[model samples]
Target: MMPCDSNMTSIVQRIARQALLTFRSPPRIGEEASKSFLENHSKLKSLMTEVRAADLHLVPRRASDSPPAVPVPPPVTYMHICETDQFSMGVFLLKSGASIPLHDHPGMHGMLKVMYGKVRISCFDRLQRSPQAAQPGALRRSVLRSTAEYTEDSDPCVLSPDRDNLHQIDAVDGPTAFMDILAPPYDPDDGRDCHYYRLLTDAEEGEHTEQREQKEKEVWLMEISQPPEFWCGGEPYPGPEVSL
Candidate 1:
């Protein structure tokens, strides 16, 4: 069932409050409080019905519905909800087969909750390199931390400053939309900027390589400009106004 829209406190408000509690103090916040905030964030599906197709301009397709000859929807779009000193909250919509490429949010914490359809997320972590081996402007070593698929029924995918900080998101089967929150929002002037990366693997490896070996493999990531293929258009939020 959809949540009632008449509530005095909107979901965005609740999210903002939780974000403040989670990020207000970086050096002094207690572990228990941080865990509690994440737990609350994971259980926030009930608060954000606006991200679903029924609330947006997109129509839900039935199984019998014929596929359109031309899919004119933008490949990707964003709906900016709100932002403060503590966090930024928004929604991203992806057309079928569209993807948000591998990227890193420097010194940021994030949560992603699917409001409709499913997405495959591949996450990675930067590994420390030996000082002697580290070269200026050379590719960095990273490990594939995890790769998983998420649907509306699943809990939000979480990331911190160190863990799962670099990842890619791909829409599966059909159009997908997800609510995203980032703490201490990106500020290029403050050295918190989004950087794009691509994973480098050994091309000589056989295609029949073992899955376990693939997971254990260490890869290098090369920083690059944003791919020309991926760009985000903006759409106005069609939900209740949030004040913060």
Candidate 2:
């Protein structure tokens, strides 16, 4: 096990403190951040890529093989590491064949780094809404950004308010675990809330406005209730203690 409050802070501890300083005064959406802020963000990204499951003392929590009569638990679990007003850090564990459904992080910046196993992540960017866009109850226009698999050795998947902000993650082949960092954690009162969605076919978009470019297809994503099949349980973080 890693030591806590030692003379030298572990990578996880440093990540927590750096995240605090990096997001304390984040740049406004749609604006370019200052040089110093960008520099700090770059450093943070580097640190995140360096983290491993061993550093956090994490291992995949798989569904039991002998489960005929056993009451199966939720497929996902969250291990809370630490948090501050500016940021929150945690790990999400997914059992084999489990998935975290498509969701949006409203007005936030985030990073996802696989700590173990592998995950296929599909990312999307919400397009600007027009006057003739779908009504309040209809789907929102989004553009598929990318879909890729990542392992512990991969670079972190980064998301910002306006770029690749909505995504779905699925465990590949077996159980998976990843570290998640979100700035200015979701606060419904502050108008920052999480919303779930599912991709709809182009025909379902039903848009009467401009057509999507043939090169880059635009699709619709309908807001949905959190998928009933998925839920997140909790676990204790067994890594070095993080303080900010």
Candidate 3:
């Protein structure tokens, strides 16, 4: 049976319930979550750990399969599992050398779990601005929190409304796929819309390690139009159906 209650059988269905229970009433943005909410969040993370590619009926694709006879596929693909007023769940698949450019999740919480192959994620957090900083068009001062690679065996990557809210994801070694969950799904009227960005640097081409590690840990980023080379196509979720 579909996930009409707590009696869900599939891990996917179970994850949907746990996510629903965890995010349905999360504390407001920037506010501290109560103990109960924290506990539920932990459980949700644990459940996510138990998910796998086989569980979702997803198969990894070839590293580079561009046949002239075949329709050229988008660099990335998405398999939407479910969505509600509180959150959205889906899977992202990236082809070899494909990347999802740096983007922001305004006032949202998210979790990403690698299902097949590997992915490298570079995370950033906006920094406090000063009057003298750069009026450098669309640029926002920020700190690069982390740049790490993950595989199916790795635990889910976590993001909060205020921390590590911007990131770029690239498929590593080969094609990659990951399951993603976002709370309070994007709504333009609600002021939660997606934005793309790229790093703004003073140094050109192959500058030096100095740019990456100023010890100042600060960098400038400018918003940009969606990367022309990157586009996401949707696929049907072939796994067990989930419902709340």
Which residue pairs of candidate 3 clash?
none
- TM-scores for all candidates: the values are 0.75, 0.89, 0.87
Winner of 1 and 3 under TM-score: 3
Clashing pairs in 2: none
Write model 3 residue lDDT over 96-121, tens digit each, in one string.
88999999898899999999999999
Please rank every candidate by lDDT, starting with the best: 3, 2, 1
Which candidate has the top score in TM-score?
2
Leading candidate by lDDT: 3
Candidate 1 wrongly placed segments (more than 4 Å): 1-7, 27-74, 129-137, 204-215
Score candidate 1 by lDDT: 0.72
Error of model 1, residue 5, in angstroms: 13
Candidate with more favorable, higher lDDT: 2 or 3: 3
Instruction: Report how far residue 139 has shifted in candidate 2, in Å.
Output: 1.1
Q: How close is candidate 1 to the true structure, as a TM-score?
A: 0.75
The lDDT of each candidate is 0.72, 0.85, 0.85
Report the C-alpha lDDT of model 1 over 1-244, residue by residue, as the tens digit.
7764646565566665666666665422113336665555544533442345444344443334454354554578888988888789888988788899999877777888787888999999887633543223456668888899998778788887777989999999988888888877899888687878777657623342332244565677777778889988887877656676
